[model samples]
Every structure is written in C-alpha cells, then in structure tokens.
Target: MTMASIAAPARTAAGELATFCGSLRWAELDEAVRQRTRELLLDLLGVTLGGSRVESSSAPRELAQGAGDGQATLIGTRQTSSADWAALANGTAAHALELDDVTTESSLHPGVAIIPAALGLAEELDASPAAMLEAIVAGYEVTMRVGNALNPASAYARGFHPTGVAGAFGAAMAAGRLLDLDDERLTHALGIAGTLASGSLEYLSNGAWTKRLNAGWAAHAGIVAARLAGAGFTGPSTVFEGRLGALHAYTDEPYVERLVEDLGRPLQVMRVSIKPYACCRYNHGLIDCMLSLRGSFGLDDVERIRLGVLSGGALLVADPIEQKRAPANVVDAQFSAPYASAVALVYGSGSLESYSTEKLADPRVRRLMSVTDCYRDASLDAVYPRQWPAAAEVVLRDGRRLSTRVEYALGEPENPVPLDALMSKFISLAGRDDAEALADRILHVDADPSVRALGTALRSGGGST
Candidate 1:
C-alpha cells in the first residue's frame, strides 16, 4: 500500500481540533469508553508509581522537587510542583518502565503524555473527575488523529519517535479542555503544540535515558503551549498543513484528511492496548509467540529461532542484530526483539524484572539471543499498524522444527486483558498492599468530585508532599 497525496481539508486541522476539544464532554462517551478510560488512567498511574522506584527516575523526581511546591501531584512520590514541572516528572515516570498503554493504530503512548497534563492541571484547578476524564478523552482523540495523519512508518524511518511527537498534541488538548478554552484559544494551543513537538529516535541506537524523557518533555511543552494560548498568545493556525509545519518537516506524505475523519463515532481510547510486557509495543506479538513456545522447547535443545515480523517493525528493534543481541542496558533490552525473544525462551516470561542489569549478563540469555534471527515477512508487513502479526519458528538440535503465528498480543483490543488481570498486573507493578482498594477508588474516579482525593491516596504510600 502507498501513501495518498495530501489534499485540502474541508476544515483546517487546527480548526477541527479546536471545535472538538471545546465541545467534547465525558458524558458523550459510551459506558464502555468511560470505563476503559478509567482503566487506562489507573494502569498508567500504577506503572508511574512503579517507575518512580527505578534508578532512572531520580533525576526527574529531583528536578520536580527543586521546582518548588504547588498543587500538582507526582504519581509515585509525595511531591507537588507547578503543573508543567509535575507533568515533566510524572510523564517521565509513566514511560520509564515501558508499561504504559499504547494506541496501536498510531504507534503512540497517549496516556503517558495526556494523563500527566490532565491530572496536573486538574489538581491545580481542583477539577472534577468528570472534567479530568473529558480532558483524557479529548487528548487521546487529537493525539491519535494527528499521529495517523502523519505517515507513521515513514516518520519512524526518518528517525522520529511517534510517542514524543504525537504526545504534544495529546497533552495540549487535555490541558486546553481543563482550562475551559474556547475554540479559538484551543486552536492556538494546538498550533503551538505542533511547533513544540519533537523527539529523536536516536535513543534506539543505545540504551540511553533520552527515550524515557521524551514523553515528559512533550507533556511539559503542551502545558506551556496551553497556558500561552489561554494568555492570548497566538500561533500559526495552519501549523499542521503549513508549508514549514510538522507534516512538511517530519513526514514523507501527510494523510491530512485523517485528522478529523469519522470524528467521534468510535472513541479511540477504547481501541488502545494495555501492555502486559515491559517491552516495546512492536515486539509484543513476537514475544507472545515465543513465550507460548517456551514450554515445549528447552534452552539446551534449541538450535536456532527465527521471527517473521513486519519490515517497518524491524527498523526499530530487529535489525542491527548484534546490538539487539547484546543490549547494554534495560532501556536497550526493552526495544530489542531479539533480546526480548531470547529472554522469553530462557525465562518463560518478559516482565520488567527480565530487563534488569544482572539479567543482561545472564550467559543463557546471550547464548539464546545470538542464535535468534528476525526477518521481514510479506504477509506480516501487509497487515501492520492495523494488526501486528508475527510468526515464530524454532529449530531443535535434533532437526525437529516447531512454528506458530500470532496476530494479536494478549493485551491487544482483539484479545484484551480482562479488568481482573489488569488489576493484578497493576498490583504486581504498584507494590502496594492496599493497591486493590486504591485501584477500586481510581476505577470509580468518575464519581469523585475532585482528583485531589485520588492524588492523596497515591502519595500516601511513599515520597514527600
């Protein structure tokens, strides 16, 4: 399939987004959408709490604490700071563990950027849970729409991280909704957000900490953009379709019509996939297939393992086979399909613990990774971005071969992880004894008058306020 030529939209991208953000209300969402929104929010927050305990979080957490005190709450810690600072800290933490929810169509993590912006601003304004939910829904819609409009595979190939770039719009829309901005002001916010959106894919080349910080930076940029627009700052209205704008600068071809196509019939959040593994979303299907095959194949008896993946998916994690097999750190392992597959073979699982520093040196993991081969399959590539299909072939030392294919990962919309499973996953990551009760409160957050109560519950576990 080829990208279509960009055509003039009946309405400008910014104008359409402004109209949607200004008029959207949580009540307009169906019951399932509302409940899913709550689930995703809770999931992200749970992971954020878990992420705060990781070593990478120290810098961001310290930065937020140094920014001075305010109403915003940091997810894992008991600290408060200015809204933008809190977004930076909380967004960073949400993405640190690679456990955040993903919008498969756009290949972006909406909640990492949207939740921090919405929750931070909501706390500052003492916003109602209904209002917070509205911001999240609006944020997700705008982010995914813009993400789809940009030819995502081309963008990634051009060395752009979709989450960091698309996240700015998600953050801006959420903040704009919470600020109660009119269509005009919200349009300005989106325009400003488009210019501020930036993230490099260079981090994939190394186990650098930059990937963890991209979402936080986007969240911070969005809050500042929204605040500027609310203060009467004007930005170019045609930021998306402008000659020197995001689409022209970052993508090969822009599907401009997707920005507002089928505006609100099906809420995008309901289609998002909550990750079960602490690895890149691109590698999930292959990891699923590998884990399923683990029970039958012994590490010592396996000769070679092959993975057939979408060609575009290989660009991010599969190629550079040597680097993928010898990931320098946890961040590197999370994006490496080879490393992830090998871990699944040796350990029977690929949870967050599997990426620890000590695990990287496990001789068994390295031996298995060295023998794993990943290549593009025409069939898999054909259905990518819509269906993340993957196939696994295992060769035994005795010449016996076993193969299996998976079209959807466990957490994908087609085969969703149930709420009970989600809750247990959250508990495992959250590390709190009373997590179930806290989760109950968060799942029913729509009924709460303000987000302050939930914020208090999160902070009560640890950190300083």
Candidate 2:
C-alpha cells in the first residue's frame, strides 16, 4: 500500500539494476512469463543452429578469428572465444535466419539480442541454473519496458533498427544479472549501453546480412557494458529520459512515461511472439491471409493478388516488390512479403524451401510473386503502432477473387503461437530433427541443469538448415 510498492522503480538505485534483475524470485513470477522465457530460449537455440547452415557469415566467423581460442561455444562454426565474443557470434547466428521471436508492439526481437549476452556470461560466471533463467526474464522485461516507453513506429519509420538499438540495454541488464552487480553498477551498465546502442533499417533497402549481426553486436556490447561497470566505471543515471538522449534523439514525440511505470509487473517478455515464418513479422499476417485464401483458389485459378497491410509495415514487406520479389540472396528473400506469400500459395506451405534458390527461380513461384499487388489498407492502418494486422485478396484468372482479413496475426502476442508450435518451429528451423524430443528438452531446460548437452545436441542434430 506504500509508495515503494507503487513507485518502487523510481526509488531503485541506478547501479543495482543488475542485482535487482538477478534477485528476481522465479517462484513468485507468473507461470506464463516463466514458461514464455523458456520457449524463447529454445527458439533462440533453434534459430542460431539454423543460421549456422546458411551461406558463409563474414561477421560470426569474422568475430571468431579475433577470438582465436578461449572458452566460449560458437553455435555453428568451429570456434572458441571469450564469453563476450561467443555471445556475439551465437546472437548473430541466432538472428541470422530471421527466425527469432518478435514483439508486435516494439517490432523488435529481444531474445536473439539479449540471450547471447546472458548465456555467455552464465557460462563464464558459472551461475546457477535458476539464476540464469531468472536473468533472462529480467532482461526481457527491461528491454521491452524501454521499448514500450518510446514511439516504435516513429523509430521504424526513421530507419533505426529497434532490435539492435534497444536490445543493447536489455542485454546489458541480463548480463548485469549474471555478473551480480548491485543497482548502481547495473544502472551504469544500462546508461553506458544506451550510448553504444545503434542499428539502422537500411538493410531493407539493400540485401545485407549485417542486420543479422546486429543482435550479436548489441548483445556483446551489453556484456562489455557490464564488465565496464564491474571495473568501477560510471554511467549516466537518466539514460532513457535524458534531455539529449535516446528518446529525444530517436523521435520528436517521445512517450517517456511508460519506461518506469510498472517496471516489474506483468512482465513484457510474456507479450512477445515467436515467429512461425522466416519473413518479417510485419508480413506474417498477410502470409496467413494468403494461406487461408489458398484453399479457395488453386495456382491455375489465381489471376492476381491484392495485398494490404498496416501502412507503416507495407514498406518493409510488400513495397518495392521488384527486387524484393526474385531476391538474389538469402536476406532479400526473407524481406519479401510477396515472395513469401507466393511461396505459400504455390507450395501450400511457407518454410525454408519456399525461398530456396530453386524455388525463387521457379517459373511458377516467380509468376505468382509477380502478380502480388500491394496497397495500404486503411482499416488495418488505423491501429498504427498499437496492434498491427495485414489483409489479403486473391483473384483467380477465372475472375473469382477471394478475400480474407486477419485482425491479429498468428505470431502476434494477441494470437500467440502455442508452445507446441514453438517447439515444432524450432525443429523446423533447427533442421529436420526429432521435434518431439527437442520440444521436451526445451520444456525441461531447468531439470537438466546445464544446457551444455542440449546445446551440443541442438548444434549438431538437425539434418537441414
């Protein structure tokens, strides 16, 4: 009933953020939040393993060269490095495939960026199993809370990559937990990380794989920030709301109030959605809409496709369909909504093969992709940054047009992916593996204690990328 219970966050020591994060009582946490964190972790591992099978990575392998040999496990590549570099490589690998978790509101995938930081630190610090899980949950809360305070739509519009920008601070908080820093050092790590945070949306314009590496960079920077704080360094206290800081720099209209409010209640990570498809989360709804419409029209019947989505998201997926259509590279295929939708209709499924070179160049797939006409749907666009949706309509050459609307996308928090689906998703991405066993391993992450065995199995187990 006191102010501490109400404004308890305001009284927190700027430095003890890490300890506070580390001290989270797992038993007291809502079952949903705890379970969701495990789901995310499993998903991250799957994605990282999958990314390893992709074309040569300049950054992950590049970072490994500098690491030489220390004692950190690189996901796909045969390399060893310090905990921080290992975290960076693994984070990059995890996010490389665009198969990581996504927050609908923030439009950022926090786990890919935050988990590597925590995992690396956990391995180095020899932290208890329970402590590691608790830290991950705390990291998600911190990052999501920070992102929730800002205008995510505006940030995306201006071309700042939210995952890398906000992800750094979140990774720092999680790493701080592993390091056992008091509020002072923890807060310092955050403040320092805020300045170091950065990533742009330029990759959407040009097919570049660096954005995939941003998660690792953000996560690595976070661990570095924690180490800096541990070394007795100082950082600004008002990092989030500082006059010339993050919120102000990123947007003209900043909502700073959401950052500190309900700092520890409800848990933001629980609100995150795991990606069921490899393409951008913004386009997943349209993919679903198309998938639903597939039943109505066969490839022969389909004449043209009309794709509509929240205006803000249209640019990322449906816009510039020309180059985004028959993408020459892996990253491009992942960004093309039309391509993904076409793959769904042509193949009756949207999986790794949907974007393969053979598939991308397939005459039928290209023809289907060519007909995808995209425009902004006012109905869905009205929601803006609140809750996003995509609309689709497929017209057969026979003049029959089928339309479907998705109020909430499959992967969005509102219509979250079932835990079983997440596990199945992991296997799908981790390469054809025993999905049932993989899911069980993730479900019992704590019971097995050190995930070294599971990690080892997941790294080498999958058959396909």
* RMSD in Å for all candidates: 4.4, 4.5
Clashes of 2: 9
Q: Which residue runs does candidate 2 get wrong by more than 4 Å? A: 1-23, 56-59, 77-79, 431-439, 449-465
In terms of TM-score, the best-performing candidate is: 1
Q: What shift in Å separates residue 244 of candidate 1 from its native position after superposition?
A: 1.6
- What TM-score would each prediction reach against the true structure? 0.96, 0.90
Can you write out model 1's per-residue Cα lDDT over 210-259, one digit (the tens) per residue? 88799999898899999998887777678888888888777997788878
lDDT of each candidate versus the true structure: 0.85, 0.75
Against the true structure, whose lDDT is highest? Answer: 1
Tens-digit lDDT track of model 2 for 76-195: 544546778888788888887777888876678899878888777776665665677888888887777667666777777777887888889898888888788777677778878877
